[model samples]
Target: MTRRTVRIAMNGVTGRMGYRQHLVRSLLAIREEGGLELEDGTILWPEPVLVGRRAPALRAIAERHGLEHWTTDLDAALADPSVEIYFDAQVTAARAAALRRAVAAGKHLYCEKPTAASLQAALEIARLAQDAGVRTGVVQDKIFLPGLRKLKRLVDGGFFGRILSVRGEFGYWVFEGDWQSAQRPSWNYRAEDGGGITMDMFPHWEYVLHELFGRITTVQALTATHLPQRWDEYGKPYAATADDAVYGVFQLDGGVVAQINSSWAVRVHRDELVEFQVDGEHGSAVAGLRDCRVQHRATTPKPVWNPDLPSTEPFRQQWQEVPGNGEFDNAFKAQWELFLRHVVLDEPWRWDLLAGARGVQLAELGLRSSAEGRRLDVPELTL
Candidate 1:
């Protein structure tokens, strides 16, 4: 097997998603597993340099993992000729500028989304990356999820003949941190810090719908700040000006209607933290993070409505669970491996900043739709 190494400048990786998901679960996991083997028997060992604002934390992470590289100086990391790819997982406000800087430095660019606060800035980053002739990618991790993968497989297999509608339920109660501490970081509730349900989740829904069903044509949304005040980590209450919940409906290119409800205020009743149900002419399926249950049209049960009497049939039991068809990797890790391949082997990578900009556009238009109380058409994004 031909083996080589790619030096990656990993920035803003100290935060929760950055540290836990990207660094530990994905990058480090690959390293621990002896690197990734590509189709042509080429082994790509990804050597990541942890870059963040805190020097002590970077030192700790490197020492803990037996990694030799760690640095707080982003400028120095960018200046290094050995750093071939730049990855960012910073807060929403810091992502765009860092990505632009990376592109200007002539490095292959990768980052977490929204990519930018506005569509204009996101588009600019995409253009910059293209002009610089660097490979580019953005996180679209959910599409690789096992449950979603199964759904895609079933759809591709023609199990879902003539798709109709998709309903996505995503959210959980993030405590207000009165007596118990809040689960998410405090900045997630502040608009000025770039936090909101619409901004945080619509990107996921946009890509999911676009990749699975079709491109979203129009969007209508309603957003809310259910809890106006929330306690921070320091046990201090702060005004939560950003939206904590959103109910949105999207019209896809086909007649498929997708409605996704995202909230930090709701309680979970589904199989997972996030669940999506798709209804089609031939069958119906409900897919969670890792499991999917399906019911063919012929197997669907007829329920008689009688308020006074208990239902005879077990409603939930009517559907059968789809078996896990194959072994699955961590969804984030799966995407990371693909991005690495794209960077090293010149693989086709479509999830770039332009796609990320579309995500921002959806979030922006969702806010506009909520304010104007009308459905807004999603303009086609040109690369």
Candidate 2:
């Protein structure tokens, strides 16, 4: 079999999500597996060109991974004729401009979501990619999660007969950095840095809801900065200008109402860091990060509400665990392989720049709805 190398210029590998998920767990793992084999007896090998701001950090990462190419200059990386793709995992404020540059360089695009800080910018990026005729995609990792994949399976199999509603609970307390080091970057709480739970999570919710149930038709959101003041990475005090929590109610197509609460201030009380419970006329399912449980109409428990008396029924035990019929790889790696196939073999991929723009649009509308204290109709976005 012929083996070919596809050079990818990856930006922002120094960041948390960039370093851990995209670089180490995904790309490195792919390399360790001896590359992806295409249907035509050709192996598509990935050659990562790490790009970032810091020279020392980039050098360290390159040396640690035994990678050959590392650069601090994006223009130089983009100018390389051998590079076929440009991937961004940069901060929100820096993503749009970097993506624009990549598009201008005629490289295929793939990046983490909330394509831009605003809907307009995201649409503009999408338009540029369309006009450039380059293959493009945005990361929709949550949809690739094992639990969500099983949930999608159930939805496709009509297990949720006439799906009624979806309830999602996500997030856990991120420590204020004064005494305890914050789990997330300080930029995540700074509005000037394009940070906020709404901008960060609404995009995810948009794609997840749209892919699993239907497109969101309307949204009503209530957002808050529960922790007004927090310390930064350096232990310096800073005002938390971004919303730490968001309570959103979205009306989806096909008459499904989804209520999701995203918060960094709330302590975990559930089985996983994130969970989605979908209730239907015939059955109901609760899906966490890696596990899914379902309750059919026949097996669902019926317990009359008795506030005064102690409840006897074990409600949580009523649901049956969904079995994993197949081995699942890392979600990010799975999508990377798909995107690579799309770039090389012209394979069909639905999560394009347009899908990314839709996610940004949802975030913008959600923030607006929260500010206005009223439900807002979601308009269709176009490039």
Against the unseen true structure, what C-alpha lDDT does each candidate score?
A: 0.92, 0.95
Best-fitting candidate, measured by lDDT?
A: 2
Model 2, range 11-127, lDDT digits (tens) per residue?
999998999999999888888999898888899899999999999999999999999999999999999999999999999999999999999999999999889999899999999
Most accurate candidate by TM-score = 2
Q: List ranges where model 2 is wrong by over 4 Å.
A: none
TM agreement with the true structure for every prediction = 0.98, 0.99
Candidate 1 accuracy as lDDT: 0.92
Sliding window of 10 residues with minimal summed lDDT for model 1: 309-318
Off by over 4 Å in 1: none
